[model samples]
Target: MTRALISVFDKTGIVDLARAIANAGIDIISTGATARVLAEAGIAVSGVESVTGFPECFDGRVKTLHPLVHGGILADRRKPDHVAQMKELGVEPIDIVIVNLYPFEETLASGASPDECIEQIDIGGPAMVRAAAKNHASVAVLTSPSQYGDAIVALERGGFTEEERRVLAARAYAHTAAYDAAVANWMTELADEEPQYVGVGLPRTATLRYGENPHQSAWLSADGKGGVANAVQLGGKEMSYNNYRDTDAALRAAYDHLDPTVAIIKHTNPCGIATADTIEQAHASAHACDPVSAYGGVIAANRKVTRAMAEQVKPIFTEVIVAPDYDEDALELLQTKKNLRILKVTPSEEQRDITQISGGFLVQARDQVDQAGDVFAGWDHVAGPEADEQTRNDLEFAWRTVRSVRSNAVLLVKDGASVGVGMGQVNRVDSCRLSVERANTLGVAVESDVDTAGGAQAGTAASEERARGSVAASDAFFPFADGLEVLIEAGVKAVVQPGGSIRDAEVIEAANAAGVTMYFTGVRHFAH
Candidate 1:
């Protein structure tokens, strides 16, 4: 009779699986808790010691490590010599091995002690799983409770097919691989050492329609703890690849502020970001920054979506809206837009940032803007006179907002809202020019006497007037004085940036000449 060995930390469907195996005339062998549970459920099961002939020692860690248990699972039934050795060793070939590892991740998340966490790591379970998976030609290994249903049907029909066994073997390897990765990462964190080798194992949670384009295939994989990847969709059509990217961008931008804030994102870059006293006011202000670009954009709010906010967004052609939650009236209103994707996302704790390169991955700690409390506390005012309270506040807002923009980024802020944003440029000068142009062309007028002409020169005076007192932020230092000149000429009153460029003296001199207050943060935020 065929025999199956079962051991699992999670006993979700073990009894039902064991009953099916017993009814199929297959003998069941289980370890410690699993055996006790099966016996209590009225299933005739033999302890693993019955086959290994050695009692479990080391607090039950040594039970399944014996050669008898491994030999049975590893033996190749097609090889005459392997079968002969198993017979001579009095080992019964175990056709199925069902095992799941201990809950190391759960233990870590629960704030367990080091000793407790180490004790939860399974040593023998992964060993048995690897052995059975290697000899899948003769043995089938199941690692998840979800796999039990299919395994039971296959066992009831005599046995699993070769293809089925191969698939199970592949899943078994992935299961062990992910478990090992979690353990390794945890140990590295405990030791407080930079890992020489990093392992990442994210399970696929979704299959997207395509990649950045329609022809390329794409899928979404995540750790599933929290964040945009695991956000709950409440309404709208299925999300596409671009939708997830833009929504994540919007969420990050919105959450970076302390007040009620909204960020409108397009192509993973923020078109507008603003913080206000209410969600509705914030959304209106942010949308006013670039009304044309806000169409079909993704919007994220740090606060719950209120009915007033929903009413403001209803008429726009928005692609997605992500927030922590939604008021009943707000959700009901937004759901009317059937094709607009609505997501409820709870922010997860910050994690390491990993990017894939040609040969391998580049892993680094997240460049959090708030890692240092009060980003402006250490800034040096190197040029012009001291800024007024309002100008200083706008400078701080621009500095924080610029961190989320792409490289060669420059942002203009007035009254806690972005007036103009220029990003993804090849040079700082162009970004400066673009930001000034956008401020004059698309930004809301600071005065009522704004020129109404549609041409480039129509609002030249009013555009300069609007930018007169606004503060600007640069993601990095200006390599030359030309970038600063552009902002100063456009009427920017103050600026904030990291100041380590080779031509820092020239840039500072330009600011001083223009009487524009300039502060150096000594830190750069470069988002590629």
Candidate 2:
């Protein structure tokens, strides 16, 4: 008769599995709690100690580490010498091994004590799993509860094929590998040292239709933490690679504000962002900043989507919209747009930023706005008179919003809304010029006077009028005075930057000459 060894920390569906194995004429041997549970459920099961001829000791840590247990699982049925040795050593061949490691990940997530966490790490379980997987040609190994159903059917039909056994063995190895990665990462965290090797084992959650381009095949793996990966899609077509990228960018920009906010993102750059008392008004203001770019952009709202917001968005062609939730009427209306992907996500704090290069990955702590040490507390008034209350508020909003933009970024903000954004430029001076140009060309007209005969001249005056008194933020310090001069010439009233340049004095002189208030944040935000 075939012998099957079963041991698991998670006992879901174990009783049914044991019954099927017993009916198939396979003797069941279990360890510790698994044995007791199976015996109580009226299944005739033998304790692993009986097979090993040794009592479990060291708080059950040494139970399955005996030579007899491993020899049975590792013996190759096709090898006459191995079968002969096992018979001489009185080691019965075990045809099947079902095992799952202890709950180390769950224990760590529960914020358990260090000693408790260390105790939860399984040693013998992974050893048995690896041994059985190594000799998969003769023995079948099952690691997850999800695999039990198929394993039972195969056992009932005589036994698993070599191909099936190979698949199970591969899964078994991945199971133990993920468990070990969790434990290793936890230990590294406890030791408070930089890890020499980072072992990340995220499960494949989705097989994307394609990558950034249709020709490249791609998939998504997730750590199971809350974010866009786990978001519930309420409506629309399947999300593409670019949709996920732009949606994440929009969500990050929206969540950066405390008040009700909306962000419109294109190509992972914020085309427009605004904060207001209501989400609807915020969307309106953000869209007004650059209505042309907002078309087909991914939008994110910090608050729930209401009917009023839905009505405003219905006219525009949007790719994706992510929010915490949606009102019934709002969801109903948005669902009518069949191709718009609507996602509901719960925002979670991100701990790390990972980037992949040719050979390996680069990991670092996420650059958060709050990590800059109290937004305005470390700022120095380097030039001109102190900003008034309204200008100060705009300065703070502009500073927070600029962090989401790309390197060499410059953002112009008026009344807590981005009027112009220039990013991904080669030089800061060009970025400054682009920002002013967009502010005058794309921004909503503040003056509604008609001068149709002098159309171009009137539009320029109106654009400059809208930009006047707007605050500007740069991702990094001004390398030269020319960049600061561009913003000053565009009627920007106040400016904020990291302020660590060798030409800081020259830039400050330019601000002082123009009578523009300039503050240095002492911390730079450079997003590549």
Candidate 3:
């Protein structure tokens, strides 16, 4: 009779598979829990001890370490020498080995002690699996419970096809791969070694609808449920991949607001960000920053999204809106947008950042928040027009937003609203030029008096015609005065930035000479 051995950690399909194999007149040889489970299910079985004529030893670690198990699994069916050797050793030919390793991933995640995790590692199981997979052309290998049914079906059909065998062989390797990676990760964490097992245990969160656009495929990586994954839906529809990306940006910007704030993001950049006495005021300021970009953007309120807030937001074309809580009417009003994704989540505390490597994971706490006051190793330009209370607060706000942006980033915020954002440039100067260019191209020439009477949905040039005055934000300390000169030429009248460069006096002198107001936030936010 053909024979198979079965053992598994994830017993997803063991009982039915064991029955099917037994019904095909195959002897089922198992060890310990595998045998007990089979016997309880009323299936006939041969225990490893009985087959090998040796009892399990060393706290069951030595259960399957016998010639009977290895000889049968490793024997090459086409080689007369191998078959003769197995017969000479009184070993019954084992046609299949279905085994899975211990739950090391689960144990590690459970905060298990080192000893507990070490004990859960499976040695004999991997050995048997490797042996069976190596001889897969003649013997079937089933390293996972998920593959049990397929293995039995092939046997019942008389023999496994070459393609079928190769597919199972590949999966067997993957099973071993995931198993080894888990153990390595836990040990690495215990050793406190950076990159010890980076990229090891992170699971793919989902295959998104598409990446930045419809052509590219994308997936999300998140700690399952309660982290980024468990944000609630207060209203609207499912988020596409791009929506998640932009919403995360908005959340980070909202968090940077030291006061109760609101932020709106489009395509992973801040179009609007503000802090104020209420969510409504903050939202309005943020919206005014770039009302054109605010359309179909993601908005996040640091506090609860209120009814009044919802009423004001209802008129815009928003893609997603997030907050901690929503009043009854607030939720109802938002529900009207069939495709607007509404998420309720605690504003993310600046505490977690995840990095994945080729074979493991690297986790770290968020870098400290850099607030604007005097964040430099050396504060430059002090007492050179101490920032007005409004400029000072705006300085802090600008610093927070700048840090969340890409390196070589610059933002322009005026009257508490983020007006222009320039990111991902080649250098600080390039970023400065880009910010000024963006403002001039979009909202640079203040036209605050442009007629909104034509309706809020009015055209862009007309809208830019309405905004008056210019303000700017930079992500890092200015290395020289030229960057400030560029902004002034572009019509910017105020500046906010982390002022740590040694030449702050030069930049300050230049700004003062030009009659432009500037503030030092003293901190920097660099996402890279």
Candidate 4:
């Protein structure tokens, strides 16, 4: 009679499968708890130790590692010498292997100790599964409990075809690979440095409609826990690739603030960010910062969404809204916006920043500096007038906001809210000019404008007037006085930047001459 070796960690649907297999005249063989389960169910089953004639030793770890178990599964029925050797060793062929690995991922995730986790790692199970899979032309291997019903149906109809056996074997190999990758990743995470072998096994968790654009193909795979993959789509149309990117940016920006914060993201840069006493107020303030750019933007809040907040968001043409939680009424009201993708994300505790290039990828720790504490306590008041307490607060807010922008970035802030931004410019002075122009477009209120424009330039005077009283933040030091001059000419009140440039003295002199307050944080935040 054909023999089927059954061993598994997850016992779902195992008994029913075993019953069907046994009723077809196949003998069932199991070890330890699996054998007891089948025997209690009135199914005659042979213990693995009985077939091997060797007692399970070393805390039952050596039970299935015997040559008898492996010899039977590895033998090729088509080879005369293999059949002769199997008969000489009194070994019967194991036509099927039903085995699932130990729950190592679950054990590690549950905060288990090293000893507990190590003890749960399987040895003989993967060995037997691999052996059966290698000789799949003559034997079949099943790794998942979900495959049991198909196996039973195939066996009841007749023997599994070669194609079926190949598929099962391929799946068995992939199962072992994913299990091993998880273990490797766990070990690497515990190590202080990169291990000799770094393996990333990200099983495809989602099949996206397309990549950056509709013409390209794309998918999302995650090896670790928590991220956009785990976000619950409470309602609305499917999330597109760009939607995920923009939503992540919005959420990350929102997370930077301690108060009830809301961030509006366009493309990948945060167009507006605001913090207030209530979530509704924060959302409204963020939207008001840039109403024109807020169209079809992704909005993320760091607090629970109330019905009032949902009602506030109902009028805008938003692509996505993500938060920690939402009230029942809020979710129902938000669902009325048919195409708005609503997501409740349980953000990951450990964040790793990843960037892909042409050849390989780069991984680094996330830059999540604490922005709530006293960031300006040790900074130098380099030039111009000393910043007052309120100016210092707004300066710090602008400093933190510019940290998220791309390199060559300039941000204009008023009252802890971004009024204008210019990012990814090759020239720092150009970025400053672009920021001033954006502020003028937003109609930001200003104080007096300097006559830096030649011969009564009305447009330049109006632009500089709108940028007056706004603080400016630079990701890096101003290499030349021209960049600081642009902001000073635009009527900026104060500025913050890392003061390590070679021409730092010239820049400070320019600020002092123009009566613009300048402070140096002594650290640069260059996001390239």
Candidate 5:
């Protein structure tokens, strides 16, 4: 009779599977709890201690680690010498191994103590599974409870085919690999060691409809810590992968502001952002920044969603909305849209930024430069008129908003709100021109009424009214004076940038000649 050894931490579906395996005329050998579960279910089972003739030691941690257990499972049925050696040792072959490791991942995540976590790590289980998997031609290995029923079906058909055994062996190896990886990752975290081998555990969360496009295949997985995986979908359709990416960006931008803020992101770039006393006002101000681009974009708020805010956003076509919480009435109102994904999640405090390169990943700390009140305390007023208190506040706000934009970014802000954003341009001059054009188009530009001044021809009255007093923020210093000239022609009153370019003097001279206030932050904000 073929003997099967079963050891498992997760006992889901074990009793039924054990009964089926026993009814197939196979001898069932299990250890500890698994054996008790099988025997209580009226299935005749042999305990490991009975098979090895030695009791479990070290609080059962040493069970199933003896040579008798390993020799039986690893014997080569095709080799007469190996079979003779096993027979000479009075060892009955263990034709099957049903084993799964301890729940180390869950134990680690549940705030367990180091000692408790260390005790939960299984050594014997992985060894037994690997041994059976290696000798798959003569033994079968089952790693998951999901495979129990199929293994029984194959046993009822006079045992599994070579192909079936090979597939199960493959799965068994992967099971042990993932288990070991989780343990390694957890131990690394506990020891606070810079791991020589870094591994990210990405258990599948969902199979996305497609990746970026329908023709591409995609799947969603996470470290199982936070972000969209933990977000509560109050209502609306399932979130797509792209929706998660865009919402993540929007939430980061929204949380950057201390005041209640709203951020609208499209294609991973912020098109609108604002802060106000109430979420309603913030949403309205952010939407007014670029209503056209805000359409079908993800909107995130750093505060609770109120009914008033829901009503204010009802007219716009938004794809997703995320917030810390949503009032009951606000949730009900937003649910009426049916297809808008509304997610409520407390943003993660900190996370590493990861980028995939040709062969491996490049990991670094997240860009979390504090955007508090004193961010501009050490900034240098390089040239032109000094920024007054109000203009300084606006410049700081614009700088924070510009940090979320892609490289070659230009942002215009007035009254703690982003009026226009130019991003993903090839040149700083184009970014400046794009921001000015957008500000003018959105009626956020100051109406230009003056003739030629500072070698820049002003726009009409409407343009001057919107752009005249707005402060501009560049992610990096201007390489030439032409980009600074574009902002000057748009009637930009103040400029903030990281001053490290060789042409910093020329850029400062242009700002002074144009009579525009300029501040050097001395730190660059470049987002790709």
Candidate 6:
């Protein structure tokens, strides 16, 4: 009878697969819990201990590594010498090997002691998988319970061909490689060195139908180390390759702020970001920032999604909504929009900043997030140049947004609201122009939305009221007054930024000259 060896951590469909194998007249061999599960189901299973004559010792760590198991899996039926050796060794060839490795990723993520994580690493299982996979021309290898049904079905229909086994073999190697990578990553992380670079670590979670385009294919892998940024599937249809890229960018922008914030992003650039008294307020401000650009954009928030915010979001057309969490009410509201992909990525313990260069990986510390606190430590705002509490709050938010934006960036903000932005330009003045144009396009009040909303109640000059709702911020020091000059003309009343240009006095003088208030946080935030 053909022999099948099964050892797995994820017992998703083990019993049924074991039963099917038995019905197909194949001898089932399993180790530890897998053996118990199969035996309990009245499916005959030969334990690895019995076959190898080596009792599972060291609390079950030393199982399935004996010559019997390896000799069975590594034997080639087509090779007369190998077949003869297997018979002489009294080893029945393992025609099929089904194995899933230990939870190395899970153990590392559990905030467990180092010893605990080390203990979870399965040496024997991976060895058998590789042995069976290496001889794919004569053996079938199954590593996941998810693939068990398919493998059993293939075996039932006159067994897996060389091509089928090769596919499983290739996946098995990738699985072991990815598993080893995660363990190596965690071990290396215990060291304290940023100058030295290591490698990336992740396990394949799923394979997408295609890549960014239909012609290409791709897989969704997760850094199994659990934390806020671990692999997460919030909700939505199968994510296309484009949606993941755009959604990731949006999450980066959204998480930039320590405060409750929201950013509407399109094609990797942020179209709007706002910090309001509440998340709802931030969303309204962010939505008004570039209402036109936000259509079909990806939205990300720093805080958990609340019902009120979700209600407001339901009215808009968006491709994806990403946040740390979604409240029951919010999730209920969002569920109605079945096509909108929801992504909930909490900060994960295992996070690596990775960049692909040439043919390898460039890994670095996650670019740190700096909080905009005490930045203006002892300096008065150059006398007569100061910001109020509300203005300062908005000022800090604007400063952070500028750093995340493309160079030659301009960010417009006010009262915790983002009005307009112009980014990725060759000249600062062009950024200013784009900011004003986008703000205008969004119908953000040239002055103040608060006044417009209030003035509408009082039957006053709504046009003037609306325009007062905006402010402008710059990413770098203003090299000249030209950029601020352009912004001031666009009806930006207050400006906030890092004050460190060669012509700092010149820019300050220009602000004072233009009768606008300017406050310097005394620090520059530039992200490249």
Instruction: Provide the TM-score for each candidate, comma-separated.
Output: 0.93, 0.89, 0.74, 0.88, 0.86, 0.84
Residues 1-528, model 2: lDDT tens digits: 399999999999999998999999999999999999999999999999999889999888788998899999998879999989998999998988999888887787677999989899999999999999999999999888999999888978988999999999988888888888888877887676666656788666789999999999988876655688778999999988889999999998898888899999999998789888888878777876776777799999999999978877776789999999999999999999999999999886776787889998999878786422357766899999998888888888899999889988999999888998989999999999988888888755422221122221122323445577799999999999999998998899999999999999999999999999999988888999
Q: Cα lDDT of model 4 overall?
A: 0.82
Please give the clash total of every predicted structure, in order: 0, 0, 21, 0, 15, 20
**Candidate 6 segments whose C-alpha is farther than 4 A from its true place:** 195-198, 201-219, 222-238, 304-307, 325-338, 342-351, 372-384, 445-471, 477-481, 488-528
RMSD in Å for model 4: 5.8
List model 3 lDDT by residue over 157-212, tens digit each.
87678788777777787667667776775566568845434434344556788888
- Least well predicted 10-residue stretch by lDDT in candidate 5: 450-459
Off by over 4 Å in 5: 39-43, 145-161, 189-196, 371-373, 384-389, 443-465
Instruction: List candidate 1 segments past 4 Å from native.
Output: 445-465
lDDT of each: 0.86, 0.87, 0.73, 0.82, 0.83, 0.75
| Clashing pairs for predicted structure model 4, backbone only | none
Over 4 Å off, model 3:
52-67, 119-127, 139-159, 192-197, 200-263, 275-285, 299-315, 318-336, 341-383, 388-390, 414-417, 426-472, 486-505, 512-528
Error of 4 at 52 (Å): 3.0
Q: Which digits, one per residue and each the tens of the lDDT, describe model 1 over residues 1-528?
A: 399999999999999999999999988999999999999999999999988788999877687998889988998999999889988989889999999999988888788999999988999999999999999998999999999999888978889999999999998898889889989888887776666666788766799999999999999987666789989999999999999899988998888888888999999888889887788778877776777787789999999999978977887889999999999999999999999999999887766788999998899878776533576778999999998888887888888889788989999999888988989999999999988888877755422221222211122333345566789999999999999999999899999999999999999999999999999999898999
| Poorest 10 consecutive residues by lDDT, candidate 2 | 450-459
Q: Flag the better candidate by TM-score, 1 or 6.
A: 1
lDDT of 5: 0.83
- For model 5, what is the error of residue 485's alpha carbon versus the real structure, in angstroms, after optimal superposition? 2.3
Error of 3 at 139 (Å): 4.2
Best by TM-score: 1
lDDT of 5 by residue, 93-130 (tens): 99888998888878877889998889889999999999
Cα lDDT over the full model 3: 0.73
lDDT tens digits, residue span 190-283, model 4: 7747555545566666899999999999887754556566788999999888988888788878887787888889997876776767887677
